[model samples]
Target: MDTKRIFRDFNHCKFLVFTCLLPAELFVSLYLDSVINWSLWLVLLPIWTLKVLVIAGALVGTIVWCHKPFRRNEADGFTDFKAMLITVGIQVLLLLFELLLCNKIESNSPISWILVFTPMYLVSTLSIGACIWGYKNARSTELESLISLNTLLFVFVSLKLHNVIHWNWSVIFIPLWIIMCLPTIVVLHHLWTLAFLRSNFHGVDKQSLVLDTIMWIAIDVPLLTFEILLASRLDQQNDISWVNIFIPLHISLLGLIWSTFGRKGGNTWWFGLREDFCTIFLRICPFMRLYGNVECKEREGGDGSEIMMMPVVTQVVCKSPSKCEPVVAVTHIATPD
Candidate 1:
């Protein structure tokens, strides 16, 4: 397979890289906000330096992973222009707001207010514009992805602006955290489904609509549970009751539903037991690797008969017009079946 050609598929690679980096970025931000006291930066220069270094490393890693080696033609023209404009506009607003919050200039002054408020206005406008673009160009998934990123960024900035004005940590942080998690969860779901479908269906197996339904539930139930749990925990200092009692019960119920209906094979279920099994295996295989062995294999006969064999394994493969890309194919042979 041509690595360059594979990389040229910017939509797939970009989304994957974005999904991976977002979690890391959120964690780093959390550390910076919670652990590092901004006032002590002068006294604890070394600690501040180390924190900056860590953040820099994460930023570099994200860039390396997500950066396209060769720019796609689709990425050029108006898309590039629009993305650049939005990014630049965001930065400008960020700077202005930071200045206002720090009280570098008197708030009573018209200039200060304008500086503080300009970014908020721009972000809102850009968000609406991006949404319109997304609606108009629904066919271009790449464009849609770009719009999604921009919209999310706008939300982040808007939340930040709210924080600056209200000066309430709980109100500000909780909403911001939820906003960040939204994109993270969506991206994860897409990647998970992409992987699951590629491995199970080979190409688009429209006939196996049942399998697709199972795949969705299998991926979503656990993911939604984990997300709710995580968000609840983050907001625990504000309200522990939800995280401690209701959330856990909700997760248990979701798990039970998934285990019962998710595994049952039929058009009633949307996808089959085989896919549910694959989804469950995919979810747990990483932790399982710490203990023992698992394997999955597909054997093809000349007569178009195919056999999928497993020894506790999970795999996802993407098929293109010219080539089939193995996204995740982990195998272990303890006693070959």
Candidate 2:
């Protein structure tokens, strides 16, 4: 009966599903590339499928918005609409870059790596500006660090690919190494805070602290391992199997998906779709109807001549405590006939 709770759960569920699918697809693509000589497009089929679904959902949402009978009470509907458009545009841009990169890699095209990565450069530039705006507005700038480091990594990659830099692949990956070290700093801070709280005789949420620490370790350790293995493999410093190299990545992705399950609500572009899916699912699920607390049932009237569906309340008490005794009560909602 709590619509807000239902919507919140739906958003969390959507995040869980996306986290599972997207990373799984990427890992599978990596695995396939190592095993088979499949075409890049074919290997990327799952990603394309997800993109198609997203674009289709956007179109459907746009159509429904244009023809809807009533306007939403809050302004979020319009904001979500704009967000959907932006998401689609970004998806298209990333897809363009992927296609170009794939073509260059597959056919040994003359297209420069810088040209292939232009879309990512543009995205990173926009992300920098967004991060600046966010910092000005007192929003989190943690993501800005990652974005800047990634952009630097991209530059290092392009230079290495173009033979403009003869540095070792591990050296080229210094930015990513720094990125990974950030979590180490955060974990150390958390430990320090915990120790301070304990030393001061302050109440500590040990359960939450333990869970947070475990989650950080689960995600970061595997992620760091994956990066190390990848860098070593790229540099031919190690002859580890590709499957083994990707195992840590798979573990990290699983940790990400697990974290999403424990997360609560936040604004996501699929908010409307999640709500619609939740509603339809509840309607079709018989067990949900059977177990739900709220429902309308037919009751015979006093004369036994009419049946009506009404909202019923039980265990009512008089507002004035002295006027009446507390007793079981049934209040019927009247209906116009």
Who wins the TM-score comparison? Answer: 2
In Å, residue 35's CA in model 2 sits off its true spot by 2.4
Query: What pairs collide in candidate 2?
Result: none
Q: Please provide, for model 2 over 1-337, each residue's C-alpha lDDT reduced to its tens digit, 9 standing for 90 to 100.
A: 2223333344443353456465545656465557766677676766676667667767776676666625343445655565566556656666788788879977999999888888878767766765675566544444344555599888889889888899998999998887778888877877776666664455676656866777777789898998888888888998888777778777776766666544554323353452444445544553343223233457889998777765433222112223423332246554566
TM-score of 2: 0.70
> Candidate 2, 163: how far from true, in Å?
1.4
Error of 2 at 264 (Å): 3.1
| Candidate 2 regions with alpha-carbon error over 4 angstroms | 1-34, 69-75, 132-149, 193-204, 265-337
Predicted structure with the largest lDDT when compared to the true one: 2
* Each candidate structure's count of clashing pairs: 5, 0
Off by over 4 Å in 1: 1-83, 90-118, 133-297, 300-337
lDDT of 1 by residue, 190-232 (tens): 6566566654565564433544445545545555554455455
The 0-to-1 C-alpha lDDT of every candidate, in the order given, reads: 0.40, 0.63
